[model samples]
Target: MSNEVKSIGIIGLGSMGMGAAKSCINAGLDVYGIDLNEAALATLSDAGAKAVSTNALDFSQQLDAVLVLVVNAKQVNTVLFKTGLAASLKPKTVVMVSATISADDAKQIEQQLNSYDLIMLDAPVSGGAAKAATGDMTIMASGSAEAFSKLKPVLDATAAKVYNIGEQIGLGATVKIIHQLLAGVHIAVGAEAMALAARANIPLDLMYDVVTNAAGNSWMFENRMKHVVDGDYSPKSMVDIFVKDLNLVADTAKDLQFPLQLSSTALNMFISASNAGHGQEDDSAVIKVFDGITLPGVEK
Candidate 1:
């Protein structure tokens, strides 16, 4: 059978989803967008999406593939099951789940989708909003060969790199969780280092420049700390996001009887930042948890 997906429905028109939707349109695919935000729907409509609505059931029959890019497993379950998306989709339709969720949750979702005769890909994405906008994000995915064959066009449009982990339902989510461990730790430790520099009256910009060019620099430090230096905490990604992701890491590790000291510490840092009312702020605001230092563009 020829497995070709020329039409796709995307749930969640947030930063990542909106970008992927645009990329699909750019790739000349028929795109349907579903989101609660009317403005986002209008924007996608203007971007040449074939349709936009708050409910996928409105256009589910037109979709050859469904991309779920919501925040967590709960939202994914709600959209796919409670909201009637799964029941509405045509049998054998490929569903690519790109949320940051636990491996166990991914497995459960896959089993549920199988009952509907739908193909499930446990796909989690990285590279943030900017890269997503340019169709250069990375996707770690695991699914059956049929699902991979069916989703090829959408995958090519949305991701610059796609790692096929295997034919397992949860391995993609597992890889993404492991990646989040490093990402959360790097951001937390970068905040600590910057906080120490601030305490010593060193110029944060200068510190950023030196460190970014040095061996100690990480992708998280380079990207997130720039938000700190520019004093723009407008939440490219929120503090609570890492709190959730790291908590997943912690929970997964506990299940495996493994100890993740750095990940645990980073999770606490994010928790502290969230508890301090920075939950909605950019994750770089973790630096705000440090006392007695003046942050740029904020009244101390």
Candidate 2:
């Protein structure tokens, strides 16, 4: 358990996964990358990552840990169970789930993987794709001590801040759900503020500057609002992603009888933006829900 994770595999090579793969390479680990996108794999190959032809078919042979960076619990379930990705790995291989999902699902997955003699880390990542690529992302992880010991190198390579929450599986997912709630709310609020500024004839640029330096500022306002300002709504993170994540928050709260007013409101905002055909756009595009307000990217 004290041994280093010399060889590793990461499934789902999107922005976050791609960054992490590069970091693993930088850490000098033998990294195997898997994705449906050949172009992504090609890029990783250029960066010294071995591309897995059949997901874990090639990956299962030699990974010390497998980092899962897909979209949600359903995808996580498929990768670990439906796809034969799980059975391909050797005993005691740590399965790091980095997607934001319900804690229940995380626990269930951990239990299932344990039956196969595999280790599970309910590890969800933060700081977005930019941080992920630099090996400076924050990881909220909880699992067995053996899992963490084996995953030490991978964790060191992928994160600047790591909160080892507890030995229990799914505690990490609980914290991540709370993180998403704040993120989703802040984005929604920024959109509302910018839309209000447009309605008031205030210069969007000036408003951005004022609020950013003002007490009203938040990290999401600074980060996501720029996307709105530039009109570059290309999906760094899609509106529908928050729609899904915040909805998970809503569902989980309902089970506990916990009340979350702002989360509910923000979830609807994203749902509305997605329903109006902007779901594929960046989450910042939630600002587009305001009627008749000119957005930065639009021609007047």
Candidate 3:
């Protein structure tokens, strides 16, 4: 671990990626943000990040680390192997795997990257786009001390809390699963509660305030109720995002002989909403699944 991490590169410039790029710039690191979307590049460039047009930036020789903040395992693989960026990386460059992936997948990826002699961090993030943009997200991470040493700047730039859960690459991902369980169930419960209140003729705004301040308060309640209040479904994080994450929960639990009935049920609810074509909408639209309530200004 070097005392100084002069520069780092980031792949993907979606909501989360943009936040991470901004965090890196705020940390005084020379940050190169890569994305296929020119508009995304322009935004990052305007924010003081160096924008690269392709996924093919070779950070191995010059970069201290490269953070992959893409949506899923497939995107991570694409940014690394398919795009030919991994091979071009300098030896021992910290590969910060920030996507939420299965523990098995994380281990396999770590093992594969080790063949290239790269330092790998099984790091998954939380705190959403706002947090990422503010450099205040939480990182659930596990990896070699060497990897942490190399990636400290990026981690410092992006995380307000970095939980080094364990050394095994899979543990960090497993913790992320536990987080998804609480997160998924909370969102589903919040949606159902709001819909139930609306169906029972209680004002949606009143219900939002009551539950948020009462014993039933949760992070999801705070996050999703704003959508119902504003009648906005534009995705800060989509329902389909939970659909994928909760499905990973089901699959991971089954493999571990763990029964997560509550999480499983919530996964189905999110899946149903996604199947009903609300996949791109904000996850708060899960309320739409409960039937018969007009959201004031919004249509179903």
Candidate 4:
């Protein structure tokens, strides 16, 4: 087997997947893209992918590596198995599962892939769409040595940082889930603080400036709270995305019999936002859950 991944197929050409596909193409790899969205496929085709299709099985056997960047484990399973992409692939092909799925789901997928004599990398990514577009995303990955070796080129093209969590199938997912706990909580708490400032009649822009420069600043606070200040609830990352992610955190904790007080609170905040019809809005819109505050750009 070659040490480099020369040709690759990407399943799910959403923002993140499209960015990775474009990065791979820019890196001079033979890239094939699969997505249900015609616009997404068209965009990748224009970006010089070797092929673009709605079905993963279209060119699954032709690829050296496959990156699954779908939304969840269910969608990942649907793309790989329901569409027969896994069975259609040539043996020894590296399948990098990059969804933020539960560790158990990652382990199950790994076992199934091993049954097909394919390599599986439990890889989950962060840094969102902007970073992905620049090929500067962070990847948390775990798999066998052979899998790592085969996937190195693709990783180099797609990520600024790739942490090898372990050789265990589920280790990467575990780490990503923990990371999501921090991300979700930070966004939720940041929204709460901003809402408090608004209720106190503090100018949101000034408050934002103070918080971002102060000791209490966090990456999530600085990033997500800016959306709150601008009142731009456009979905960079939707409230429902965090709802699903924090729910994953809750489910994982339940299985481990662990307590997650702050995460649990954050989960409720997201759920409340989702319940109030902000599910599709930017996650920073969680601040909308607090009433009696006049948000910027929002009419009373």
Candidate 5:
């Protein structure tokens, strides 16, 4: 069955997308790296994946599955619909979308793809780039059993844990957005707490050690604070990505007339960080927004 899924394509070649492409190669699948960036294509090619310049690709590759890990729903839509890729795919092809999107949007995408006789899988991933590279990422996924069966090899090639949420097209997206709700808020709180420590003239490393050992510890605090300790906000995941993701969560809640207090607050912090020209910086740099908060890298 793995050999049956000989050709696979990745739409975006950013950190997460690139990692997944490498994971596909590691699984011994024929992986096609698609991106507008020559450098990203080169990097994937260096890792033994076939590099295709999106502008000039041979249509004969006949991919069995294509993973869309682009930044947002807008980019996902552009890649599938506007680029004419979805319509060009043959029937029984599985088009898995891994972008963090609203359930409504995910359902809409599935319906559109169905018109082209393509299977749409709503599969959102977690565990960041490093885990993705090693194919150890968690996937919150929902799709028809037929779609799941046809795309089994593609699923195993990139995920360590693939949660079968439901047969519905958008069920996975619903869970993924809820995850963003917690992730965005947790990172924001970590930034605020660490910023307060800096304002109080506390040693950054010392405070990190204490909190990580004590009850104040959180996964976000432990993971994101390492960037602060090293003074490198080099965009592992950019502030603007969280700005967009949190806003998606807020909008999804708004439509249901549900209140999201912490997620709403965190969205503002990310927005402020973006508006202050830290948008492209790593999300941990959100601490830079607080007045008199010393960011080790920004000054140095």
Candidate 6:
């Protein structure tokens, strides 16, 4: 690998995927974006990206690196394996996997990619959509040296912090899973706090201000509280995302014989929120679990 990534391919154009594709374009790298959604494809094109309809349809085998930001294992396989993209990709063209996948799934995909002689980088991410759009996301990466070399431009363009966790493909996913545990717990706790404050007839604005400034604050607390305060359920990160992530955390812990009581509890809360038809809503709407409690300054 030359360590000089110029032309890149981005698969998926959802919120995070679009942000990442824009970040690459902002870094002066040529980006070929692929998505099934016509609106997302047009958005990428409008933003100066070369929008390709799909991974299988994109005629850019000259790509130095490919970034997979699709939903999960199934989508990853659909793009790389089903579309014959893995075989069609030029040798040493690094494949950066940014999806939130299980360790087993990561390992499986790594091996599958290796079969085509393509380098696989298990590079899951943090810092959400805003950070991604600003080219300031945190990447938890673990892969071969060659893979990293080919992915230099991607890391440069999309991540403010890239922790090269190890050489194993699944290590990054493991770390991301751990981080998701804390994130899910904090969001659940934040919802619980707002619910309690509302139930006690405490002024939610005052309570939110106090808790956010005090040691009780968290990133999720500050971010999600604003949604609760605004009664804006627009999904920055949807409730089902936590339902998927936290479930992964719980399953991983169980397999490792590690007891994570807090994560388990939070995972259940997310499940309940999802079951209550908040699955597609912003995760902050987990606060809706509290019956008959209205936020003072926000509409229901």
For model 3 the local lDDT of residue 189 reads 91
Q: What is the model-wide C-alpha lDDT for candidate 4?
A: 0.92
Which pairs clash (backbone N, Cα, C closer than 3 Å) in model 3?
A: 60-89, 60-90
Off by over 4 Å in 6: 55-57, 296-300
Looking at model 1, residue 210 earns an lDDT score of: 98
In candidate 2, which residue ranges exceed 4 Å CA deviation? none
Candidate 2 overall lDDT versus native: 0.90
Clash pairs, model 4 backbone:
none
What's the residue-level lDDT of 249 in candidate 2? 92
Model 6, 16: alpha-carbon shift in Å?
A: 1.6
Every model's TM-score = 0.96, 0.95, 0.94, 0.97, 0.92, 0.93
Candidate 4 local Cα displacement, residue 163, angstroms: 0.2
Q: Residues 1-300, candidate 1: write the lDDT tens digits.
A: 667899999999999999999999999999999999999999999999999999889989999999999999999999999998899899999999999999999999999999999999999999989988999999999999988889998999999999999999999999999999999999999999999999999999999999999998999999999998999999888999999999999989987889899999999999998998999999999998899998887666
- Whole-model Cα lDDT of every candidate shown, in order: 0.94, 0.90, 0.85, 0.92, 0.86, 0.87
Per-residue lDDT of model 2, residues 1-300, tens digit only: 348689889888999999999999999999998888889889888999865544677658788889999999998999889988777778888889998999889989998898888999999999988899899999999998888888999999999999999999978998899999999999999999999999999988889999999999999999889887788889888999999999989978996789999999999999999999999998998888889888877654
Query: What tens digits encode model 6's per-residue C-alpha lDDT throughout 1-300?
Result: 357789888998887898999999999998888888888888888888755675544665768888999988889999999888888888777889999998889999999988888889999988878888999999999998878877887898999999999999889999999999999999999999889988898877888899988999998899888888777888888999999999899879977889999999998898888898889998987777767887644455
How big is the positional error of residue 270 in model 4, measured in Å on the Cα after superposition?
0.5
Q: Which lDDT value does model 3 have at 70?
A: 88
Clashes of each: 0, 0, 2, 0, 0, 0
- lDDT per residue, candidate 3, 1-300, as tens digits? 345567888888877889988889988998887888989888888989754666546434667788888888988888887877778887778888999999988988888788887778999999888888898999999998877877888888899999998788988888998899899899999888888887899998888888888998998888888788888888878999899999889879987998888998898899888998898999988777877887755775
Sliding window of 10 residues with minimal summed lDDT for model 3: 51-60
- CA lDDT of 189 in candidate 4? 89
> Candidate 6, clashing residue pairs?
none
lDDT of 3 at 76: 85
Q: After superposition, how far is residue 165 of candidate 4 from its true place, in Å?
A: 0.5
Q: When superposed on Cα atoms, how far off is each prediction in RMSD? A: 1.3, 1.7, 1.8, 1.2, 2.2, 2.0
Residue-level lDDT tens digits of model 5 in 1-300: 342466788889988899888888888888888888999989988999765667413552468888899878888889888878887777778888999999889998998999988888899999988988888889999998877777777788888899999999888998999998888888999999988898899999999999999999889889998898789999888899899899889888987899888899999999999999999998998888898777676682
